[model samples]
Target chain A: MADPIHQFEIHNIVSLGSIGGHDIAFTNSALYMAIVVVGIAALLVGASSSRALVPGRMQSIAELSYEFVADTIQSTAGKEGMKFFPFVFTIFMFVLFANVIGIIPYTFTVTSHIIITAALALLVFLTVIVYGIYKNGLRFFGLFVPHGIPIYILPLIVFIEVLSFLSRPISHSVRLFANMLAGHITLKVFASFITLLGGFGIAGMAGATLPLALVVALFALELLVAFLQAYVFAILTCIYLNDAIHPGH
Target chain B: MATQAHTEHPGGKPQFPPFNKETFASQLIWLAVFFIALYVIIARLAIPRIGGIVEARRDRVEGDLAEANNLKEQSSAAMAAYEKSLADARGRAQALANETREKLNAEADKARRSLEAELNAKLAQAEQTIAGTKTAAMANVRSIAVDTASAIVERLTGAAPAASAVEGAVADALKR
Candidate 1:
């Protein structure tokens, strides 16, 4: 069987010359990322250009996406959090489009990669830290201290708090990356099984049908997971950003 | 050398190239580029238009509701005015009926009183005429009785009394 992992291989598409003595070549990942950006821009911009009071199908879809992200931010972060609406909205659309696009046959799932997810998580992490400190100053550190803990348990609790606090980005990134990675891999494996079994004989072909059915179900599940992961990523960003907005609670 | 090693890696290891350190720069660079591009597109174009549409719709709905409420109030006021006029018309009609009733009653009273006065005058005149005829009847009766008394005297004793004397006798007898 062919390598299922082969689907995720990044190829250097346009080998741009070395920049600052390092290979800054445009890669397949980069091409798709550009496509994601342009595609989202085109869809949203083109849909909204008519500015119809009674929106058409594309306009409704576009508007729904805007409303979805807006509601997520408003619910998690409140009115004050709306100042960062553009950034939060941008990231949600970016991740959501990437995930949905990745589900297409033979397409690379960008969010499945640890590097990309970690980078997205890192951006949220930094925003929380910077904004927290900027807004709350020293009180931002107080997030580690539980309000009602007894004096003896306070130190232990604080230690756990600090530990968990440090692990936020790791969990946040891994949650999405791991789910996509595992789901895609499982899909690939099952799809391969159908081929591997079908090649054996007539009886093997009948047996292959089960794996084929499973592959179809897994595809549907992955589509749901794609949307779910984008939502999780966006909401987590909101929750973390809330800590920045409100330092104590 | 690094590129060769990456290419040579076996599939059994599940070699995720994104995890490989060599590609971090490229992914990060592209992530930055496209993300900023998306951010700019969304911030500048998408938000303003969508937000505008939503806000405008809300404002229009509120304005329509307010206008509806105003119209409702005006209708009620007009209804009240109509009701007041209806009541005024009814009162005026009642007053006119009362006036007509009073005038009819006054005219009936005047006619009845005059008819009663005229009838009373005619009864009194008829009474006076009957009294005069009775006096004439008495005068004839007295004369006839006197003549009859004289005729009887002539036939029985061959003596006749005077009419004056007979009348005086009849009168004196009547007086007694």
Candidate 2:
């Protein structure tokens, strides 16, 4: 059997020569990202085409998707956090679409890559920094300093808080990337086992049914995980943004 | 069975492009491009239209409620005004009836008083006429008595008597 990690390979589909000492080749990841973005656009645009007072199926899906993100933001970040609604909503749709599409038999999962998730997480991190500084000025540093701590442990707590705060993007990106990576790998492994076992005989084919069942169950689990990861990503973003808006506690 | 990919490829190659520094810049570029585009589309198009729908529905409902309340107030005011006018009309009718009754009563009283005065005047005149009649009759009775006394004395004594002495005898007998 081939390596399971090979499926995650990002190869150059359109090889563009190096620009500014950098390879500007278009990749499978890029294609899938475009697909996700286009898919999202098609959903929203198609759903809103009728603009019906009573929503049709497409419109209901679009509106429900919108309200889902909006409600998540409101619950996690409160009303003031709505200024970042577009940012948070885009992240959610992008990740969710990517995760769902990735579950298809041969489609690329863009969110499975650390670079993509990291870039997204970094965007949020930067937004928090810029917004927190702009909103609270020098008082934004209060995030590192927890209130009601004794003076003796204040410095230690501040250090730990600052470390954890700086590590947000790493953990956030890794969580999504790892879940996708692991789920895809396990599915590939079980699938290879079933195929390898099926080649032996009627007895081998019968034995293959166990792994086949597991693969089916795993696919279902991966689908659930896909949605869960996206939700977690969005809610975390809201929570981080809430910190940006109110950095005191 | 699925199409077997990478069957001849070496295992444990560690060719994960995500960690590869070569593709980071390009991926970042496209990601930024797609994200910003989506953000613009969502913020500019979808959310606002949906918000407008919700807001319009809310406004319509509120306007309907307000119109209902206004109609209720207007109807109640009309009902109150109708009741007030009905009461006013009833009072006026009652006043007119009372006025008519008082006027009739006054007229009846005047008529009764005038009728009583006329009757009293007629009664007084009748009483005066009765007294005059009684006085005349008494005078006739006195003269008749005097003539009767003179005739009786002449016939009994077979001689004629003096009229003045007979009259005095008759008046003395009447007085007794």
* Most TM-score-accurate candidate: 1
> In model 1, what lDDT does residue A70 have?
88
TM-score of each: 0.87, 0.76
Model 2's TM-score against the true structure: 0.76
Worst 10 residues of 1 chain B by lDDT: B1-10
Model 1 DockQ reads 0.48
Local error of candidate 1 at residue B153 (angstroms): 7.5
Q: Give the docking tier of candidate 1.
A: acceptable
Task: Extract clashing residue pairs from model 1.
Answer: none
Interface RMSD of each: 4.0, 4.0
The C-alpha stretches of model 2 lying farther than 4 A from their native spots are: A1-12, A17-25, A49-55, A71-79, A104-106, A181-225, B1-29, B51-68, B138-176
